[model samples]
Target chain A: MFVILVYDTAAERNPTVLMTCRRYLHRTQRSVFQGELTAAQYRELTSALSTAIDPEYDSIVTYTARSPGMIDSTTIGVHLGGPGDIL
Target chain B: MFVILVYDTAAERNPTVLMTCRRYLHRTQRSVFQGELTAAQYRELTSALSTAIDPEYDSIVTYTARSPGMIDSTTIGVHLGGPGDIL
Candidate 1:
């Protein structure tokens, strides 16, 4: 599944959550990551995230695109690293 | 269609692009916006974005979710505005 993961954690745990996500996905911007993953990888990611966040505090939203090119994206300003980075 | 729009514009035009997007979608973060847009709305947004950005420089990527709930999302930090807001 291709996913766009957006997260917001307490200030103290920001690094931990950010690092964990960076290990699995591309850090497009602060608290935002996106890339492809298999069901297993997704499960693993969710598991790690669940432990990193407090249910009553932090929030993470993941959008799973239906297909590879299903996402119609546009670029406006400076180019940061993106899907083009990998294959 | 449901879409997640991410953009990275030049430092100078950032505000213009951000405000344009905010008019059509929710500002999930600094440059990330997501919401449901009709085909017409999507076209309009693209048109506006194209005019707002310099293709040679800026980049905007729009991910259209297959279905309303097809996107399985999770929240971790502070819940800014979301799908639950208007609908």
Candidate 2:
């Protein structure tokens, strides 16, 4: 399965989480990684990531299996909020 | 299962995909949506999203089950590239 994790803050993007994730998953491209992880491995990785992140920023994580159909459904957006807002 | 759909451009954030997704899933919050979809539904949604996007921006989609461990594993980041580059 492939998982896409999005964080609203740089603090949440810690080196530990990035290195650990890279160790388990192949870096498909810069800032983009892909791997087929079992449910157990997925849990371990997510837990490690959450722990390393600072609580001040919001984070959104999504996972999907490898399928052409699933890949087709994926969407992306960016929001510029009010002053001092982090989204 | 929960899915995180991230788009790097507003063009990819089409109303059709968002509405269809909302009809199937609950809106967890503004810019954040959640729901339990079968594999089939996931395929349909991703497919629709991919078609709606302009070819200019990069989009990343991630999916994961509704496990505490999985949620904990998510990570997010932002990259500022060279001149005229969009991250």
Scored by DockQ, the top model is 1
Give the per-residue lDDT of model 2 (tens digit) for A1-87.
655443343543656656766665654322334555677887787777667766545443444454323432332432222113211
What DockQ was computed for model 1? 0.47
Off by over 4 Å in 2: A1-8, A11-16, A27-34, A37-47, A60-87, B1-6, B10-23, B27-33, B36-48, B60-87
| Candidate 1 per-residue lDDT over residues B1-87, each given as its tens digit | 887887767799898988788788887654567888898998899899989898887777777755567676555556666755432
All candidates: TM-score of chain A: 0.85, 0.58
The top-ranked prediction according to lDDT is: 1
Q: What would the per-residue lDDT of candidate 1 be over residues A5-46, giving only the tens digit for each residue?
A: 877677998888887787778866555678889989988888
Q: What global local distance difference test value does model 1 have?
A: 0.74
- For candidate 2, report its TM-score: 0.42
Model 2 chain B lDDT-worst window of ten: B78-87
Model 2 sits at a Cα RMSD from the real structure of 11.8
